[model samples]
Target: MRVGSTMLVRQNLTRKLSRSILLVICIGIAFFVFGVLSSFRAGFEGSEANSERLVVASKIGGNETLPLRYFQQLGGMDEIAEVTHVTRLRAHTAGNERNIIGANAVDAQSYASVYADTYDFNAEIMQAFQADRTATLVGRQLAEREGWAVGDRVNLTSFVHMTQDASRDWSFVIAGLLDGAEPTVDTNFLIVRYDYFNAALLRNQDQVNLFGIKPAVGTDINVLAETIDMTFANSTAQTRTQSETAFMSAFLEQFADVALIVKLIVSVSFGTILLIVANTMIFAIRERTLEIGVLKVLGFSGSSIMRIILTETLVLFAAGLALGFALTAAVIPVLGDALSSVVPDLYLTPKVVATSVGLAVVFAVLTGFLPAIKALRLPVATALNHR
Candidate 1:
């Protein structure tokens, strides 16, 4: 096998350097696209799967606000383990002038109790946030990016000006950091006490965008969701509730059908690779017609000829796969930073790497099969006389 590979490398790749190089480039690009899409989907679905939480939003739409009274009502339900409400604030930091980062005003004690399963709150920080209305807790990612430490004061410019004065900037003391329980949990939110926000921005008082719910274990989550919706049915402010996974799917569907988009992209990429690789293989075999005849005359079996061709095609794919995956690994961090709000996190996991290698093997078989068949059946005399 080693001797056969040496022969193929010398007579095929070395002699046809231009064709080989072009094929490698094309294969690299195709696989790179596949790796990116797979990583995005994995990050999104993985986060949703481990969470058993539910979200209660206004029936009117996502942007509509719900009354603060709903928090008490939701908490009163026996099926719910915990409930908390939060209002979204528009805020931007230095150097991110164009991007509107998400900040939330949450009830410090209640919010901590609800998210305890997914996040660990420092006891001292929690005490500070509850004790001082101006105190805030930063997500791990935001703290690392902004170089914020305990007791550091940070000011955020809000889009909504305060009613008391036309001031847009709000300042807070960093009391603590919210650390994620798992890698999939998003740690980019800047959570502040709602009392301070409501008192500061008197214009938008006693209103929250959504309620987060945690159901008691052994409780039927879907049934509880239906019950919550039914309780508020046709009221002045109707409510809609869904599991975390369902809500994420619905939210992502607003942009595009994720499954359909993935299918179209993978299909197009592989189709292009199939044509490019097949042409390269056929040309390489045709150029080596006389060499193949000599091999057969020297007692090489037809199966051995087929093995040589298949092995050569696989080597080309392996080279491209290595380059493509390395490129994907390098690009993941930049992509994650740019799309942090949407993607949350991007990773090139071992499962994804294994899947890409399996795809390369499949490509090898498809591209090399027809050419190998031709080489196997060629008459030694006829092949020797070819131009």
Candidate 2:
């Protein structure tokens, strides 16, 4: 019975080659969009899965700075594993804002120790940073984009705080380059010694932008964050502390309502595919009314007739989905640089692939149902008597 049903579906599909090809193309395009957008949403959240760190920033927005002394006090806490200070210089390359990269000043030893796994810290790189105060370590992505190498000198023009002389005067020698082992590590930052930046901004002693803290094993992060805030409650520099995941999530929230946006996009994309498939199925059924009646008259049950139509729809959708996934894989690599900065962690996971294919099948079955039922309800004598 199944064999006869399969043969019938193939004949109908071949009879209308143009319609079959068009529907397959539509399904493929829809699935491609689904694969890429879903990957982006997942990539954004994936960055927050690391369990060991926290970010301490100002409660109020803007260029509010914390006193450097807080770093010492925070490091002394029992629940804290280590603390590192990060100040965003907000500087650009020689007054070119287009060359905007993260310019951070941090303690070399502490920073390296805390993020050893993320950043490839070798003795040679460490030695260069230690020996020279004017040296900086850049991320691999930034280096490749700007065509920089070791021993190259890069000059940055300060944007946040300008010198009295109006001279944009800060420069660093490229001592090393670092790459993240995982996608979460934000490999677009530049690291320099805090003392170098602090010494240069001695007059503006109160300005330190952010603090990165590592929590001790088994410590409650929520409790520790509250404690850190309370410790500096009376001080002039008020602080807000959160786990690394929460910290990164807060920053992403500033861009857009990510969850809502992703939901809306997915809903709309699938809804479009549903309508397309339904319309196609309706047309297919209209064209095949005579054929369906002949099959029923030949002793095929309603269930078998339904199965044949559903199988045709499923096959068409599957072909399109496979083609779309292949196209996505081939295209993403060519846009590597553009995507690296925008969607740093974007990649097609096995789960995403499975979900996309599953959605295609589910939607095809759902949209094809009404047409299948309509064909199943046709009387053999009436269907055969029709033109």
Candidate 3:
């Protein structure tokens, strides 16, 4: 057979078809795990774009309320500008005891302006909502869940807030639906007007659960957060302020360093597979020792033998990675839909694809190098006289 013939490589692979297929399956499983884990880590990391903003909550506890007057103190500071606050309410619709809603009472202008990049809002619809105090912006997912539409009047019963008459009942007009700019964003809640909700409440009327802050154009967020916290350091309503990214990172870290865990898992899997692949290549080339000697006698160079062995390894890697990534692409969207709350936007990213491809090339070289070298160094007389 011609030394450089494609038939030579094909024959070598098919001579042990089941072993080759098994190796490919092993590689495919590794890449699939890597892709899924990488995407999972990305989803848990949350949006990095909103890192510039800050969230200031009461230092007393995670769910403790903050005084509404803190907004004025925070907004008047040089570093802090355009402060927005949220008064959270836990509520469910009348007659439907099953679905609970995480609702917030916010000022329309400040809230929308602060979260402009996070949410997709219509100008006309916001204007209508602003014009009516009873209007609420229901998240698209929540709206769909409750089968609600624009202009639909929703009677809500609050679990926290009570009316002046000691009733938990409140009503709202569905002014519009909320949409997210990011697919991973959880749009399963609603927001009502602060003025209207506070006025109706019998207790804790002038309190806010969270504060959203925009720093001055050139201000450092860490410095800004420090300044804000220090301003109320000696006061009754002390605060814990952090950048949006820091807040999310802290929340995720409460469980574990998930990204690190993913890396460790992938590393172990790839290491095990690497040894398997390299060992298999060595044995396969050893089996072709006598054939290689015949090829040399037929005038084929050692360089040509090297190319054949390396090329076969690459072919195995290419087929395996292709299958693995294709499976990953198919599985991600289904996972995103099923576990939206746990892992949102679970699709493969360009960085991940590039990383996977780069790693594959390096690993393929590592697997093929020793075997290819042995083939290249095998003297024609020695190979021919061998068993």
Candidate 4:
């Protein structure tokens, strides 16, 4: 009996090929949006869970530099395990659409240790980074994009120049490539020795964009962050300190509420999809009124008719989800390198796929439900005579 009902469902679907295809396209696009948005939100969320890391920056904003003296003041504190500072510099490569990333002038010896969780630097690379003032360590993504290798010389344009007429161009040899510990690390930037940058940029001397601190184990990170911020509150350059993850979150927030925006988009897409699929199902049920009446006359129960309709809707949803997932997979390899900064480790995880499929099933049931019930409630005699 179930096999016979399944055959009827398949026949009905084959008769309405265009409508099924449209419904599949709608659901697939919705799932595609959901998958991409969820991936980006995951990156921001995971960064917040690391316990020992904190970022100290100016109270004014990220662009405002803190006095270099705070580096020593924070380093001397008993609660801190390690402290490192970085100054931001604008960097440009030769390509027209080059993803111009913000480079960092870091204290070479200790910078690697600050982000030990996200990057691994070798002894030779660290030594070279420290010894040569002209040495720059490039991230793997940037290196691949620019086709740069160790010992390769490249010229970069820095926007921070003392004089308007002075040259913005600075040259450096690629000392090493940064090995990213995770995908979320914004490895699209270059790292130059702070001392080199300080001497070179005349006006921005003795200042850093932010400081990274590692607290001692067992210390209350919240309390420590508050203490650091308070200590510098009365100073010439006041500080605002927070967990490293919070800092990244705030940094991303400056652009916009990306997750919320994505959620809103997905919501709207799904809402419209619900209407379209429900309408399609209603029209399909009406067209098969006579067929449904015949089925009832043949001793098939009303519940069986409902199940057949629900199954057909679910099949359409499943087909759409499959196509959507395939599209996502194809686009990732092309866009992954560019979007790695925002949506790190973008791929079709089992969790995302399952969530998408589950959402589709729920949508299908909802869309098919009323129509199924209506089909069942129809009087066999009336339905057969009318159509």
Q: Cα lDDT for residue 112, model 2?
A: 80
Count of clashing residue pairs in every prediction: 0, 0, 0, 0
Model 2: lDDT equals 0.79
What lDDT score goes with residue 328 in model 1?
A: 89
Positional deviation of residue 74's Cα in model 2 after best superposition, in angstroms: 2.9
Q: Per-residue lDDT tens digits of candidate 4, residues 266-381?
A: 88989998998999899999999998999899988899999999999899889988888887887766666667555545555667778887898899999999899999899999
Over the full model, what C-alpha lDDT does candidate 1 score relative to the true structure?
0.82
Ranking by TM-score: 2, 4, 1, 3
lDDT of 1 by residue, 166-194 (tens): 67777888888878877667777789889
Whole-structure CA lDDT of model 4: 0.81
- Local lDDT at 383 for model 1: 89
Select the stronger candidate by lDDT from 1 and 2: 1
In candidate 2 the C-alpha lDDT for residue 114 amounts to 70
- What are the root-mean-square deviations of the candidates from the true structure over C-alphas? 3.8, 3.3, 3.9, 3.7
Top candidate on lDDT is 3
Using Cα atoms with residue i matched to residue i, what is each candidate's TM-score against the true structure? Answer: 0.80, 0.84, 0.80, 0.83
Q: Top TM-score: which candidate number?
A: 2
lDDT of 2 by residue, 1-387 (tens): 466567788887888899889888888888777777777766665553455677888887426788888888888999988788888888778867776667888888888867775678888889998899999998877887788999999888877655445565688999998777765455676888888777767267546787888888899888998999999888877889877667666667778867678779878977987898898889879877888888888888888999888888888888889977987676655544466665666677677899987887898799889899998898888889878
| Poorly placed runs, candidate 2 (over 4 Å) | 1-5, 39-52, 163-166, 183-186, 220-238, 258-262, 339-351, 373-386
> Clashing residue pairs in candidate 1, if any?
none
